[model samples]
Structures are given as structure tokens and as C-alpha cells.
Target: METLAFIPSPSAGEIHLGPLPLRGYALCIILGVFVAVWLGGRRWVARGGQAGTVADIAVWAVPFGLVGGRLYHVITDYQLYFGEGRNPVDAVRIWDGGLGIWGAIALGALGAWIGCRRRGIALPAYADAVAPGIVLAQALGRWGNWFNQELYGRPTDLPWALKIDPEHRPVDTPDLATYHPTFLYESLWCVGVALLVIWADRRFRLGHGRAFALYVAGYTVGRFWIEYMRVDDAHHVLGMRLNNWTAIVVFLLAVVYIVVSAKKRPGREEIVEPEAEAEPEPGTDTGGPDSADADAAPEGSSAEGSSSAKEPSEDGPGRGKPSGGKPAGDGGGDGPAGAESVAKGPEPRRKAVDGPAS
Candidate 1:
């Protein structure tokens, strides 16, 4: 008998809206992806990248990840689909809920690399920015396992035990009423890992993929222990579940990467998206025709003034003298002389108004 304190499994994992079927498993995955992109975009922008770059990259990564995850699940659990009495077409039904995180991440990285290459972006920098968000996505994705009533551990009588329907229970343990909620454990672990990554990244200034490596290391540590608890049918190696070995291997790889990357690339990337040189205004010029015209305008004005001053005046030689030899004070000859006088500091007004001493 299931206790009131135990977590209850969903009665049905799908909802039919008219003729359409909405699977909780697929909905959880989609929701997780959306949240990852939204949070990753914010982080990327904080790192000096464009706002939409994460979402744009997700367009490539999401589809590739889904395919890779499905492929991995099918390949690893081939017996579940291709076994006696099972139809081969069952492998293609992803809405039925089977996805492997290792495969998703591996192929997702490839997709992200392709996307980054196309945009001329640095993948390591982007990975660091999105590390925490990725872990958060994993946390959300674990809910899908809960909805499917899968990945739970051995029978337990704990207060927080998950109550599984008899139909969904393991054949050997059909009488079991409750089991350890490994999915919940992993989900909570992922949330903690995300917070740790964020905190560590801020505290240590982790960069150049180190932040991402830290996330992987932390996640794998939890997964290693959690994998041991899961009672799901899976291939075993050396008497250990396949995922336990994977977790151990992946954890070491992440650690080594963090160390090596720190040594090889000591500091963070200076710029996420290098600012392009600003183009000049359309109607402006940098020493072009407009500049030439500007230069010529002052020269032409000065020349016109000098020529008008020196021209044999219908007045006098000194300029505007009314046909007499005496000087004219209307300042027609003051252009060049007055400018020169002012530049030399306070002198006589006569020097500005009249011509220089012969």
C-alpha cells in the first residue's frame, strides 16, 4: 500500500487535446530547452555577446541533440525495442520517452561548434557563458523521467519514496508499492550543480571553458552515485551499470580539461564579439572630395580678399582711399593684416587697421 507522504506517479503521461496528443515527456524536454536558451542568452549578453546568439545557436543544437539522444537511447537499449514481440518502429517513437544525456551533450557540442563557426564566434567562450544554464536545463529535463515513471531506484519504504503504479513497476518487483525517486535526486542534484557552477564561476573568474568543465565534473559526480541507485534495465560492465562507468570516465575527462585549459588559456577571452570598426557616415568624408572643398573654401576666400585689397583701386593704392594716396579705414585691407596682428597678441589697433610698416 502506498503511503500518503510518498510521491505519487502520474496516472497518465499524455494528454489528448481533440485529435492531438501532448506527451509530458516531450513537453518537459521542450520547456527545458527554452529555459536554457533564455538563460544562456542572458549570460552571453553579459559576456559582451549579441543577445540572440544563444537562441540562434540553439536552432542548430536542439535538433542535433534530440537526434543524438534518441539514437543513443535506441542503440544502448536495443533489446527494449528490437527484442522478441517488440516492433522495430517503437525506436522512432521519441515521445514515448528515451533520451541519453551523454549523447545529447556530445552531439549538441558538435552542433554548437558548427553554429559558432558559421557565426565566427569562439565556442569555448560561449560554452563558459552557458554552463550554468545547461545544468539548469538538465534539472528541468529530469521531470520528464518522473512523468514517464521510469529511472526510479530499488524498492524503499522511505517517507519520500515514489509510489509507482503496478503497471509501470518492474516485472520482478510487481508487488512493490514505493521506490526511491532517483529522478528527483538527480533533478535536485542538477539544480545544486547549476548553483555551484554559477557561484564558482563568479568567485574564481572561471573562463576559457573551465566553467563548463566544472559543470560537467560536478554533474557527473552526482550522476555516478545516482546511477548506482537506478534499478532500470541497462547494460552492465564489470558488474556496474553502463552509465556509472560513463560518469566516471566523463568526470575524469572534465577534470583533466579544466586543468589543461587553465594552463593553456590562463585568462578569459577579452571580447565575446569583437566590435567592428565603425563605418563613416554616408554623406561625410575622411580627406575626400568634401574635405578638399572645405580646404579650398578658406583658401579661395583669402585669395579673393587679398586680390581685392591689392587691386589698383579706383580709390587709392592703400585700398578704399577715394582716389587719394592716404589710407582708407573701412577695413577692406584688414583681412590678412588684422589676422596676423591678433595672432601676435595685443599690439596697436593701427597695425591691424593699417598696413604693416614698409
Candidate 2:
């Protein structure tokens, strides 16, 4: 029972601030969310997206992910809440702990899709940008399990084993004081997954959701082995845990998607957000020849003015006029006719400029 080093479970998962209560589980989840958004925003901007786009999309994604995570936990472990003499209301108490990563990812993706569609962003590009951040968030989120003292693995006497309080210990292992800290294992695994995704993404330039798929595959690989060590109650299928099966299926799907996506889309997206393409650079001509003509109109007016000045002589009052005091051309004189000639002079020059521009 004696261990040289071990992680001790928190005595209490929540602390009261006067009348307010702060749960460590909730705090960890919140901190993870902030980290994800911050990192995702940076990566998104690095990929030519707007600064706030990731946070904006997360507004939709986070809520949906929380709800989906809760729903998955409640449904999968229905006996804990909906069974005989159980209070179904307890299912809504997510602060107590329990969230399914699979459900969170599935529904969170739907939310992200909605946000990306509204913002005119490609979902695959957004997924690729945020993939590493998402895995990092999962790394932080696993600490929530540590706070709750739940989801520990089989009992162990190893130096790094987690010490569980008697009250928190599973009924079947009443004498065992230490168990594998699956939370820590999963947390560390997620960090590794995040690093792997970042390195591979940079090296291979994964796009079209391939980076996201790589994260899924890497995460599920760890989850499958980690899930095997957990002693928590779970539904079993064909002698294997339901989650194990889920992990296998998800991993295979992720691998398949990575291969197919890489073949279909061979490079990283040149533009993550469509709005970037629409923004015109300063001093750049985005409007074509008509705009060029408008810009040149001022110069043409100045030229016309100079020509008009030269046309009239500085002799007597009627120097340029004929003996009968009439203008030479059909343009009446220096009145409306001269004004019209000056105005029309720019038209021919404008047309000449337009020819090459067109």
C-alpha cells in the first residue's frame, strides 16, 4: 500500500466563494475552452483567416459540444440516472463530471459547420486550422476527471499510481487505495496528439480536413489502449467495451478519410476565409477599366483646360474671333460652344486610353 510517489485525489471538487460555488471540473473545462479559442484563433489567422473567426465559431461550437457531451453521457450511462429509484434530473448536472468525447466532437463539428457556412468559410479549412487546438483542449479537459476522482483505472501499487479516497473507491475494490490515473494518461496522450498534429500539419501541409482526421486517428489510438485500462462501469459489446469498439470504428474512419482527402486535395488551402479574397489591396485596381477612366478623368480635365488656354490669343478682346465676330467652327463662339469643345476634347483621349485597357 506504501508508494514513494503518487497523485492524491482532491479532497473536494468544489469550493464556495461566499454564496457562490466554483467547481474545479467546470473551471478546467472553461480554461480549456479559452486555451482552445486562443490557440485556434492564432492558427486561423496564420492560415489567412480573420482574427476573431475561431472565437466566433466557437460561440456556436462550445455550447453545442457541451450539450452533446452531456447527452452522450446520459444516454450511454442511462442506468445511473434513468434506472429504478434514480433521479433523472441528475443527468443534467454536468458539473458533477461525465462527457463523451465522441458525442462532443460529432455535435461540435455540426455547430462549427453552421458557423463556417454563415461566415462564408470552408469547413475543412477551418477544421485543419483548429485541429491541434482541439486536441490540446482535450488534454486540459481530462484534468476535470482528476478533480472529480472518477474514471480511474484498475488498482495498482506502482509509484505513480493515483491514491483514491475510500469513499470514492469503486465498491468492487473496497480494499484497494491506489489505481491507474487514466485521466493523467489520457491528458498526456492528448498533448502528444496535439504535438503530432502540429508537426505533421506543418511538415505535410495537411488540408481538406486531413489534419483533423489525423488528430482523430491519433487520439483514438491512445483512447483504445487507455480505455482498456479503465475499470469504470460501461456497456460491453462482444466482450469488449463499447468505447473500445467506438474507438476502433472512429480510428479506421479517420484513417480512411485522411487517405482519401489527401488524394483528392493535395495541398493546404490557399484561402481559409472567402472574405480575404474579396478584400482589395491598397492602391490595387480591383474595378477594371471604368475605374481607370474615372481616375484619369481629372488629368484629362487639366489637359483640356491647358489646350483651351492656348487656343485663345492674348491680343485684343476679339483676337481669335473672325471679322464678323463669329467662332470658326460650328461651336458658336467662346460661350457655350467653347465650353462644349473643352468638355468633348477629353472624350477622344479617354476612348484611346480605354482601347488598350479593354
- Per model, how many backbone clashes are there? 0, 0
Give all candidates' CA lDDT scores: 0.82, 0.86
RMSD of 2: 6.0
Best by TM-score: 2
Candidate 1 lDDT, tens digit per residue, 1-358? 5556899988899868899988988888888998899989998888778879899888898898888989889999999899789999999999889999999999999999999888888888889888888888889888898899999998998899999998899999999889999999999999999999889888888888998999999999999998888888999999998988999999999999999988998878778766322335477676777566556643334333443444434555544543445554433344666346345532333333346869
Backbone clashes in candidate 1 total 0
lDDT of 2 by residue, 113-227 (tens): 9999899998999988889889999999999988899999999889889999999899988888999999999999999999999999899888889999999999999999999
lDDT of 1 at 175: 93
Which candidate leads the pack in lDDT? 2
Query: What lDDT would candidate 1 get against the real structure?
Result: 0.82
| Regions of model 1 farther than 4 Å from truth | 1-4, 16-20, 275-358
Clashing pairs in 1: none
